[model samples]
Target: MATEGIEAVFIETHNWGKSVKFFQGLGYQLEFETDHNSGQLRNGDGPTLFIAEVPADRETPLQLVLKVADADAFEPGDGVEVVTPFEDTHFGTRLATVRDPDGRLWNLQAPAEDRS
Candidate 1:
């Protein structure tokens, strides 16, 4: 499979409301929002998100999204928990997440950056 480019970064926030405001203060705009499990933001480039209501009970740290050439090359080890698998999204990309050895979460994505 061919790899794409960096798409976006998703930050799992315990409170999307405050996180959104914080990011907006940092010059990130609230591009879109939903009543459900997610929201989207932009910082003059692409979406750098602050998702709300991600349960604080999470066993991992903040979700850091990294744009990769191919998501298939990424595989989790024993310490890395695969919370989600790579799959097509409405946003036009394949995305996945895993907890690294240090309990840090990462969002590995395969998709081109949005120029819109």
Candidate 2:
């Protein structure tokens, strides 16, 4: 099936506090923050923004997260490169990585299957 749309934007920054304030200044509200300098923010009906802090020595690129109803139902048609298969995430979702024609990477996220 086709991807639903962008679900969220994943951002990694060296300065977590500054990044959070930057987005807040742009009208995004902090939804929930983790103890480890990570959090989710939202602005009206727009996609959520998930921010994480990384070490200054680490280089992390911004990522756009796509939504899929079910990971098992996703199809990567010809010309679509699947860099990794969907796997369970600690935050409670199944995520996969794919590369576009221009070599930029995007993340695909699906609701986690029921564990019960």
Candidate 3:
């Protein structure tokens, strides 16, 4: 896999405003937010951070998302477990999830190709 680097870190927060404020206090400027209580932020040239409100019944884990050249072509090495298969996301990207040896979840994303 031709991995680029960390793309974004996803954080699930119970209080969206508080979380946004906390990151803002740390110098991350809000780039954009969606109606569903999710936003992307960045501090300088650092990796982007994505914060979203967790649903009542779902527990969202802190996922480290890595940028890859092609999500469909990524294969986990030995001892790495595939949690979710790569699929096209509604947000215009391909995403897959994997579990590390320590049980941490990692998200892999590939930007959508231009159909035009």
lDDT of 2: 0.94
Candidate 3 lDDT, 39-103, residue by residue in tens: 99999987899999987688867877899887667766778788988888998898888888888
Candidate 3 regions exceeding 4 Å error are: 55-60, 72-75
lDDT of 3 at 34: 96
Q: Who wins the TM-score comparison? A: 2
lDDT (0 to 1) per candidate: 0.68, 0.94, 0.86
Kindly list the per-residue Cα lDDT of model 2 for residues 33-94, writing each as its tens digit: 99999999999998999999999999977988999999998989899999999999999999
Q: What TM-score quantifies how close candidate 3 is to the native fold?
A: 0.82
Please, what are the lDDT tens digits per residue for candidate 1 over residues 1-116?
43244456656767768888888899988778888756888888764674656787863245556676756575555565787888777767777777777877677787643449
RMSD to the native, candidate 3?
2.2
Instruction: Output the number of the lDDT-best candidate.
Output: 2
Ordering by lDDT: 2, 3, 1
lDDT of 3: 0.86
